[model samples]
Target: MCQRMQMPIITSRYWNMVHGTNPKEVQQDAEGMQVMQVLGNNMAFGLNCKNVAMKMGLSMPEEPEFTYTNFIH
Candidate 1:
């Protein structure tokens, strides 16, 4: 299954420098996500990001930044 990941602090609207990047997607919903380290507007990590988030016990709309609710698998 797909999911979300830890977005960089640069994602804040004030720091958005990615040419056409739009980091506003939740759950990698085939939507756009802001990429700072990389140029161009695209899904930088794609589903791989979801995997990482899962491994890290993360989910969409990362609240408390580094915290995740217990989701039963």
Candidate 2:
């Protein structure tokens, strides 16, 4: 009998969270990307946050827990 071998591909890495590290480490390298670059790259985050607050008839909390726990009547 013959058997077939298979390999798996992994896409995500935890090191992506750290900031400003080159080949030094995968985690630091990936995470180190600019902040505004990431945020500005994705417009939906801000709009989505605002929409959620508006739907609840709530305003941006001063403390900014951003939970939108305040329900609008």
Candidate 3:
């Protein structure tokens, strides 16, 4: 979806996954929480940047040329 929408994908120090069946157990997963926090922070940073750019009247980059091919044919 990010690729399709031309949005930058933010990555964290670790994959965002909490291996637990319950909320308490999931919360106990410290590493997962950290990763989620990182992801959230990155997203917030991105949004802030975009907002600043808009406020400064900065233009967005042009969309790249896209070509579709039917490989199955």
Candidate 4:
């Protein structure tokens, strides 16, 4: 769904999920923490790129136009 809208989806070496029943357990999940860090870095990079492009007057893609309709009554 995000791909369809041209949005940047941050990815990591593994799924961003931690299986823990308590805060301490979650804090010990190294992989999950790494995934979160990677996601944050990616988000920052993407935002920086957009900022630079805007400063350079690079054109951003136009938003898609659409109409919504009710299919079920």
lDDT of each: 0.45, 0.47, 0.81, 0.77
Residue 36's lDDT in candidate 1 = 36
Q: Per-residue error at 6 for model 2, in Å?
A: 56
User: Taking the tens digit of each residue's C-alpha lDDT, what string does model 4 give over 1-73?
Assistant: 1213366676766787876799899889988888888877887988898889879998677767667999999
- Which one is best on lDDT? 3
Off by over 4 Å in 3: 1-5
lDDT of 3 at 68: 92
Stretches > 4 Å off in candidate 2: 1-37, 60-73
In candidate 1, list every pair of residues with a backbone clash.
23-33, 23-34
lDDT of 3 by residue, 1-73 (tens): 1223376887778887777789999899998988899999998998898889879998677667878989996
Residue 71's C-alpha lDDT in candidate 2?
Answer: 75
Per-model TM-score on C-alpha atoms: 0.23, 0.27, 0.81, 0.71
Better of 1 and 3 by lDDT: 3
Candidate 4 has an lDDT of 0.77
For 1-73, candidate 1 gives per-residue lDDT tens digits of 3434456432332343423334443325332234333323333555566679769987577345356778898
Q: Quick one: how many clashes does candidate 1 have?
A: 2
What is the C-alpha RMSD, rounded to one decimal, of candidate 1? 13.6
